[model samples]
Target: MAEKEFENKVALVTGGSRGIGAAIALRFAGSGAEVFVNHRKGAGSSKAKAEELQERVALMGGRLTAVASDISSRSAVKEMMETIGREAGRLDFLILNAARAPFKPIERLLERELRDLIQVNYMGNIFCVQEALPLLEESAGKIVFISSLGSRFFNPAYPLGSMKAAMEAVVRDLAESLRPRRVTVNAVSGGIVKTDSYKVLRQHMENLDQLPEHLVVEAEEIADVTAFLCSPAARGICGQTIVCDRGMSNALQRF
Candidate 1:
């Protein structure tokens, strides 16, 4: 096997307590990245789950810390970034993964619901990038936004898709502006990964079964691409959204 590529490096993954986020955090830990796992509030963050993950990473001989913060709040993001600074001193990777949405059609969403969706999914990502920039500057870090197929395809039930698409645009802008600072930015647009979020999606989508088994990706598969985006080997790739859907987007129906 290969050596731990992330040895001695440090990373922060938002929504790191569960699903694709948890998988990403563990992959970083497995690669020897001291990870700051950020879990959000309400139905999002879970202290118990975070603690469990920390223990598992510890067993792997890697360090991991779980911090509960509302990514939609500037103050919370600041506090979390500050804590990482004091303890870790530097940050090598920022994984924008924490997100909240009603998992319903846009027409069914209330005004407040739409506002909250934008706040947590779009603005929250900006808050993390802005606050974590100092530490990222110190480490000349990398940022990987955990996007979804909804960003590109028609997912009327998935209200959060717009925000994901918006962030992908931001990645392109940031990639150019932050180039002088050597802080690369990118995104991973994942397929239908069987996560808790998927469970919610299932309630709204009638054609979930239309997807073939081969096209349905695993959480760890997305994690693998995320980790690669942070690796030295990906230095040349910037401002890009690497689609990891196993070709699910390539067709409508199969024989």
Candidate 2:
């Protein structure tokens, strides 16, 4: 509950260039955590924007490092972990926020689409956790995987929902398995975050506009919850998916 509670702690946030990941990265930096903002850079990637973010984060008081690695690649993840270990001997927090997917109907899913879905959404996170284990073990690190309402509430066109749901299960499983080691695992299933992803999602789901303004979840709100989960105050909580949707999940089927 004190200011700069994360002083000297090390945190890694995937997809931290913008949106919820950005909010989480800034939150950690502002709280005095050394932040590593990780992004994927290649064709059509936001390498420029990510670099700009790196510059902005460096201006903050906390130590900041902008890293680019394809989470889907085992070698890339290994290299990323090596860099972190070389620079900072330990990692205190690993926020799983990066997600790459092509939103489409499940029925129309192609072989390539399915493979990528597993690679980027599911296996990608697995690789991060596996690679981060050593550094995290050294520090008893906290892990928070960002999820969405689609994981629970069915979205016909939201193909990423399945992956989100799968990670939540992983969170629960790892939370118990790693408890003896002092590591914590949890998930935050946000609702209707109006980020750039939402813009793309709107094209697939028309009902987005119909949701009440009060039901929307903000990136900063998600960031704060995530920060709390990583803090000592939340040590009592684990293996849970905290919903931050302004009661939106209960708002449906209104009279």
Candidate 3:
């Protein structure tokens, strides 16, 4: 693809301050799309990381807008979409990558944790869709939710899996429901990627250290797949969760 394959396009990547979200934001910016990097408001580190990403993009002669908004708030999500519309005029891609939850078993979750799990992971994404629908419909946009292997295969102490599973269902429903409007929705369920969160996960899932090196998935690898999903090459695909696990999920031994 050309460097400017996505020139004149606009993309919003929620939770784009770090990890896989950061990678996706950079991917779109590198492809000549005006990118919005969304980080939670009041998160100093996250905001700083987003600024760093913005600087990096600027060095590449690309534009990246760092928007601070908490996806969990309906009002915040609406304002975010409005900001995008005002600044970019149109939105072509909405990447749902924000997630908040403790690394604990479902049984051990506190009421607040459970509320956050549902509100941020599941409902927060729904809020983004609801708010961005108008701008998306205007551009025949694409929505890609970031999911995980834990959603399908149970992982020890990973409470976010249930929300991932739920959102995958939404992906399918939205794909069909919004088909007439030409707005496609899909998901990317990544395998084990060594992001900052992996350090914490390693403490709970000892097996992560024992997994074969070849089974590890890189953040950039996931970004590449996401870019493809939004590209014309993926026109035939819709409402599907494309797994980027390096085939690790295919081997039963990993479980």
The local distance difference test score of each candidate is 0.92, 0.89, 0.93
| TM-scores of all predicted structures | 0.96, 0.95, 0.97
Best by TM-score: 3
Please report the TM-score between candidate 1 and the true structure. 0.96
Best prediction by lDDT: 3
Stretches of candidate 3 off by over 4 Å are 1-3
Instruction: List, residue by residue over 174-209, the lDDT tens digit for candidate 2.
Output: 999988888899999898888888899988887778
| Superposed Cα deviation of residue 249, candidate 2 (Å) | 0.4
Report the error of model 3 at residue 142, Å: 0.3
Q: Model 3: clashing residue pairs?
A: none
Q: Candidate 2 clashing pairs?
A: none
Candidate achieving higher lDDT, 2 or 3 = 3
Error of 2 at 95 (Å): 0.2
88 Cα displacement, candidate 3 (Å) = 0.7
Supply candidate 3's per-residue lDDT for 5. Answer: 83
- Where does model 1 exceed 4 Å of error? 1-3, 42-45
Model 3, 1-255: lDDT tens digits are: 455889999999999989999999999999999999898965678778888999999999999999999999999999999999999999999999988889988999999999999999998999999999999999999999999988898877899999999999999999999999989999999999999899999999977899888888999999999999999999999999999999998877874
